[model samples]
Target: MAKVNYPEEFAGFAITDTKDWNKPKYITYKPKTFGENDIDIEIECCGLCGSDIMTAKGGDHGWGSITLPQVVGHEIIGKVVKIGSKVTLHKLGDRVGLGAQAFACLNCNRCHNGNEQYCANGVTTYDGKYPDGYISQGGYASHVRAHEYMCFPIPEKLQSIHAASLCCAGLTVFSPLKRYIPKNLPNNEIPKVAIVGLGGLGHLAVQFCKALGADAYVFSRTDSKKAQSFELGAKGFIATGIDGWEKEYFDQFDLILNCAIGLSGLNIDAFLSILKVEGRFCSVGLPAADEKYNVSPFTFFGNGSCLCSSALGSREEAVELFNLAAENNIVPWVETIPISEEGCETALTRAWDGDVRYRFVFTEFDKAFGTGSA
Candidate 1:
């Protein structure tokens, strides 16, 4: 029997089994029909995130609600190919990007107040349920359909591959950092900022802090990334594996962006112990295991430090980060892989092994899926 094809079908890669890494197969799936307020983008590049890891390796610890045979690349960059009747935000041939989110209930308070990322009725780019009862797919495909509101215009100065990662990784760190910085402070007033990991998010955080006139520091397990950290504008490097590493920097940082992937061997109390009075420990990393960090109540009260977390950023924040990157000539350190079945498999395996420098972006989607109509 011939498989039934929907009116709107796009080619993409998906994994059917979580236990098998070699199981990602190219497939065609139907997207939601174009609405008056929507636009369709022919994807140019898509960056793989740690969240993709969690989504692909499904289990109790991973994203639990993901439907099978999911297309899971959220950090997307492309050119708008088609726009609906009422889509005023973008037109045909406009360069655009979509982050981790697809749509939000515009009537919600959070959406109306410019915090749409927290909208209770929000839909994610992938593994999400849309209002029209269609499962949301992501940018790891030749074309992506999205509501116009979630589509951000990519800056002319920002490269597509870089913009793809920034749609999520850059915004994740930029949102909280921008919110925390005091507006009255002078540009020269160096706030002490520490980035907890040297991977995708932390690398971008270092650049953002430096561009925002803060003294950036990197806390890592070894000196392997020390040179790269300094090159990326870090003021200092602290290897936590070294004995008494936190003693010298006691009450040092104004804020710590905790971007580490896991809490394994991380002394949360000790990290919090070094915060200045009223300092913040903000986390953006999603752990793969059900793990808890040991922190005493006194740890919070003693240093007057607070803990907070941020997820995929709001549209406003994404724009702000994009503008900041454009102004500062900020670019993420990424390794681009040409889009192919074998290449994607290797990229996923490398990401799983924690081997990439920072980010893995898949490019040449048009060639991968045959030429897309733009």
Candidate 2:
């Protein structure tokens, strides 16, 4: 094993100011104190997520104001270099991945019930504070120290770059599909699932829905992503930008997973009209705080549908997602950029401009951080 100095101050590209968030500066800062249940990972790569940009831009965008000099990449894949005395889940040299969450009060009912992602006192991977007053940093750095439970073993068949985004985007969609879609219907009936939008989350949602025995479909404003959606196992594509697009699919879906970043001009009634009676319209994509679905009691009066949203998934769901991905060869559409200040800026800028086909994953961490093992 190559020796890591494990510097007291970790280096990363940080958002020093909300006004210029895209221009993250390379800087070194102290991480939260390592604890009995904590493990240190030498970052191999990290995935760029919409939440990272939202957090970088600050409160007005709805993700809330972040502490200055925050390192903000949560979809992290790395090798464990250090483990706490109480850590039994992982050992040195194990490749692992962590998503949006870093810590949760393990004693909580939610945690005990396999819903740790919803723990009220949960701490996010970045822009979060530990109980001892240390601000948690993220994987846009040489190393990340997280609780053992938050770290998941990466499947051998899943490449680090490919597995990185699965930490967040894949889990976000997988959790909802696993919860709403049942396995093995009495007549081998496959659930009909519609993924709204065809971006990072939606693309993964389509693959997972198909992997889980659902007949997945894509709903996008235009035909731009229609062909790719079919390639990703989508059974059908609906060009929602067209007038009267919802007429033919009335009450046809079992679930509609909304993965659009914003609900700004969405036709809620039209979407609801496509769901079967008691079907669900679940939003996993979080838009700006001010962007909301204009729905009321009458909105669901037609088919008695339910409107809901899912949080980032739990550890169990993450493990299941990785295993399922390995078995089904579920690969996300990703573009890679080496980790650097310039790379961070470009990734954030293009993602904000809706220029990425799917996700951006940072690579070449050893070249940037000199933390590669022998």
Candidate 3:
């Protein structure tokens, strides 16, 4: 909790216009009077997620009209330098992090039950408006002022650079694994897990599943990521583009996590065929514009299985995720960039081109003169 009053103005990134969703012009934000439940953090790092790009150009959000000229960062890790009068869960100088969520309708049953992400009227940390119409910026700039209710203290055991990316991407996979997988399977049957795609979320999924004792496997269109996947402790790798490969691992995995993007030509029949009886197929991939699949009913019924979907997990689950990562020594494969990179068009163009090894992060903030990077 920061005791002193904050500067009337602070530095942050804002997308004030809906131009190219990728190349957002940087802007500054001056915060309101320090609220009793709000704490200000000096950001250390933020991971560039796929949604940041989507929000910039706009997408089929269940809600109407995508908010633009909105700062588009969410995966944030930083240290609290100020605390509100009523905040006790965290204190001043404590290392902490915030995810895609900024505020939620706590009065709703979802928030009351700890599933804040599902709240219908939730305010995203970036490019969203609270019920009061305050547009929430993200971690692309130097400092973040958010309600303490939406933040968590990252444990000291984890390093800040690594900790920055996990608040969201790390939590994205951890949530479902804890919720979907059996609570306590025997060591031998820890559940054979297969991760599709090897990007930001996919890579973390591999680490989370591997550290959780699953015989983790990686599936890519090609074998290019084979060595890196194994280095992350993957037990096996398969290239789906190769012919006659599906027969080798048919009915093998207990849980198949699809992390790849775009659904065109997706071999639904093939991927499902690899699942054991009563196995599950889950997805976190955001398909390209107007993407769809052609799956027959047999895909689920034939295997005595079903499909499940999840967003990021609860606040409690996020903490548990950090604990698990610390205990298991799991770390994400990441590439850091200065916030000056101009996120929307330039940053996202590179991302879409597969220019990033795994994840791209933004760092270094300056308050007086907008973002130091751009």
Candidate 4:
């Protein structure tokens, strides 16, 4: 007897890190079968997050041992082919997007309060935990399987390639921007926001902050991204090395989103010096879990400030972000790559070296979208 092939059980990339890029052979994966609760996505694209590099190595930064040879991606955008029997949140053939944390224990306090990403124990789409001890996979391949709650419908106006970075980088920054906006300042005054990195997450933060009505600023170690910053809606750009830059914007930011993955040589005092009194400095850039940092003890006491961090976002937030992007026409700046291209290793290398313009979104739409082997 032959078991029927469910639509969600599409063949896709099964990646297994071969350790040596010179002899590159990746194990692309295909689900053995599909379940009713599973939704299959035609993985149109996936972004290259900094976390992906740290995760692939499985080192001391503190995510513990990553599932080697595992498909590595989470910033994903795609189209759906099927939904489960019990699923009511989504339907067949929806343009949807998914992010880092996939599912959570709904009974937990955080999950119940619309912060499922903070659920004490939850399943991340990749390099994370689940009930069955099965290591979750990611969107690096041609297709992906996820629960209905973890997905958001894509805005009709969004370009799928650009929408890919919005999942992780977009959501990570989105949660903080929404929280930092002053409640009484009227909708128009979204505040002056500064983003500390012009990489994968920082670029998206620029677009998001601009879309939210904030005066956006970009801070980079070098002035290389000034042109891109303007194109992405940044109202201002600051090169970190300018001798008097600190004095100019001191106390100017109501909110500062730090997207710096590593804090080495980071002028913590200098970065904090720009915040207004009672301002919040929120960080979304994480270096695995073992990375360490020193908070400015005196700055907090004197400036009346606090520091915080966020873990992705909730299912409801996903819906809101989806509609927001749709309504306002926010566009993410990204570089596209075909999933079957031989240069994937090269792209991963460049991403590791921090050479990618903003992000690398793997277009897994090959074969399925009138393209072949790619």
Best by lDDT: 2
| Weakest 10 consecutive residues of candidate 4 by summed lDDT | 1-10
Per-residue C-alpha lDDT of model 3 across residues 18-48, encoded as one tens digit per residue: 4555566656566544678888877777888
- Per-residue lDDT tens digits for candidate 1, residues 1-374, read 12213236887888777775434778898888788888888889999888887887778566555687888888999988888899999988999999998888878899989889899998889888887789988877878888899989988999999999998888889988887754454555678888999999999999999777788899999999999999999999999998788889998888899999888878888888888888899989878656666677887987889988887777888888899899998999899998777877989989878899899999988778774544
Summarize candidate 2's per-residue lDDT along 1-374 as a digit string, tens digits: 22334657678889999888899987887778879999988899999999999989897674777898899999999999889999999998999999999999989999999999999888999989888878889989889999999999999999999999999999999999999985665687778998999999999999999899899999999999889999999999999998899999997899999999888868989999999888999999999766767788999998889999999999999999999999999999999999898999999999999999899999988888777852
Which prediction has the highest TM-score against the true structure?
Answer: 2
RMSD of 4: 3.8
Q: Under the 3 Å rule for N, CA and C atoms, how many clashes does model 3 have?
A: 14
lDDT of each: 0.85, 0.91, 0.75, 0.73
TM-score of 4: 0.88
Q: Write the per-residue lDDT of candidate 4 for residues 56-165, one digit (tens) a residue.
A: 65554435576655777888877776677877877777778888876777788887898888888877888676666667778766667787788888777888887778
Q: What stretches of model 3 exceed 4 Å from their correct place?
A: 1-6, 16-19, 30-35, 59-65, 183-187, 341-346, 367-374
lDDT of 3 at 322: 89
Clashing pairs in 1: none
Candidate 3 TM-score, true structure as reference: 0.89
Tell me the deviation in Å of residue 254 in model 1: 1.2
